[model samples]
Target: MNVPTEHLLILSAILFAIGMGGFLLRRNMIVVLMSIELMLNAANLAFLAGARQHSAQAGHWVAEGPVMVTFVIAVAAVEAAVGLALVIAFYRRKQTVSLDRLSPTGATSKAN
Candidate 1:
């Protein structure tokens, strides 16, 4: 299907805004990680929108967007895995996943 680039960009912007809000406002580590993922998806959508628009204008196949998207997805997956692992470790050490409970160094207390 041929969707308008403007609409796609608008959607991406909205998603990114929401993600940024969640990341900044939420105290839960898991929620913050999810917000990051949402932001990443928003970026992917923007990339696809640009690629589609370029393809339509040039009347040819373009692989740049899709290729970049693939790399983004891979990187996102790794980010998620590492983030979740860290969250788990944090919870195990602190008994809570709330960011507010963490100290300036991100630990529950002095490591000492």
Candidate 2:
């Protein structure tokens, strides 16, 4: 059972597109952040597949790739933490998570 590189590329492209769509369409900050993470993972998958297809893939350690992925995951985690904190504070002040209710000036109605 052999898989072609083209198939992997196509799959990666599709995953990236779906992730982008999710990021664009979602209003929830958490969901949007997750979509961004998905897009990054899709790109990482494509990079690894391409590396596998190449004859002279640098570095003997597979851990290198995973380390980079781990870094990305850490970044995503930090982003999620910060974003969720902001969302929580916003909800506390405004009583809503809807993006439409958020104001740029941080002035929320007290009548929630």
lDDT of each: 0.93, 0.75
lDDT of 2 by residue, 11-108 (tens): 88998999999988988766877788788878778766665566234545445556666677787788878988988988787677777676677786
Tens-place lDDT digits, model 1, residues 1-87: 767899999999999999999999999999999999999999999999999999999999688999999999999999999999999
Q: What is the TM-score of each candidate against the true structure?
A: 0.92, 0.74
Overall local distance difference test of candidate 1: 0.93
Which portions of model 2 show Cα errors greater than 4 Å?
55-64, 109-112
**Residue 30 of candidate 1: its Cα lDDT?**
96
TM-score of 2: 0.74
Clashes of each: 0, 0
